[model samples]
Target: MRMNVKLSPEMERFIQGKVASGMYGSATEVIGDAIRRMQAEDERLQAWHVAVRVGEEELDRGEGLPYTPAALDEITEEAIRGMHGNAPACRDVLP
Candidate 1:
């Protein structure tokens, strides 16, 4: 497929740099990888929103954990640890 797309000079330079680094083959490959990541993020966000809604509903029905700052922090930390453990190797790219 062929498409005409316009990009700011800065973005063009960024893409060119990625290609020059030998990590990506071409601008199209870089763009496609970026778009795929964006799509995955969108899906993840949608799922998160759904979970939030479900949690809200549970709260309305008095079926959720009691509200406590300490408990919330603990839950958040646990979730983060679980996610990090399950995340792909790409996450290792970060410190």
Candidate 2:
């Protein structure tokens, strides 16, 4: 798909550098990869927003348990079961 668009100078330089480094064949390819990533992030944010909205509605309806360290731990562990180890926080992945 041929399209015309303007890019910031820094972004243009970055795309050219990627091509020069042999990471991408052309500016279009670099732009395509970025577009794909942006789309994925958009989808993720949409899902997260829905979850947050629903949770808030539930709270407004006076649903949910009282805060407790163990309860929080259980919820956190279940959410991250497939993310890393049994329950590794994201920070654990970096350092």
Candidate 3:
């Protein structure tokens, strides 16, 4: 495939440099790699958006747990103690 496009001076130099360095065979390879990376990033962002939406829906239905600050502090302290072999794990303390 043949295509014509314009790029900033810096971007043109960057692509040319990659080819000159023998890492990329040609400008097409650099552009193809850049597009692939952009696509992967888009896919990751889409997955994150879907996860956030699902979490929001769950929150709307009150499907999450409620933990007080004091309770969380106690859990953290217990975890630290467990790490030091001074107490059982927090899961052991849970019902």
What TM-score fits each model? 0.73, 0.69, 0.66
Question: Whole-model Cα lDDT per candidate?
Answer: 0.85, 0.83, 0.85
Over the stretch 2-72, how does candidate 1's per-residue lDDT look in tens digits?
Answer: 99999999999999999999989999999999999999888777777887899899999999887699999
lDDT of 2 by residue, 30-85 (tens): 98999999997787777778878999999999996889999999978876775766
Candidate that scores best on TM-score: 1
What would the per-residue lDDT of candidate 3 be over residues 17-83, giving only the tens digit for each residue? 9999999999999999999999977877777788789988998999976789988999798777778
Instruction: Flag regions of model 1 displaced more than 4 Å.
Output: 69-95
Stretches of model 3 off by over 4 angstroms after superposition: 67-95
RMSD in Å for candidate 1, one decimal? 5.2
* Model 2 pairs whose backbones collide: none
Of 2 and 3, the candidate ahead on lDDT is 3
Q: By TM-score, highest first, what's the ranking?
A: 1, 2, 3
Candidate 3: the clashing residue pairs are none
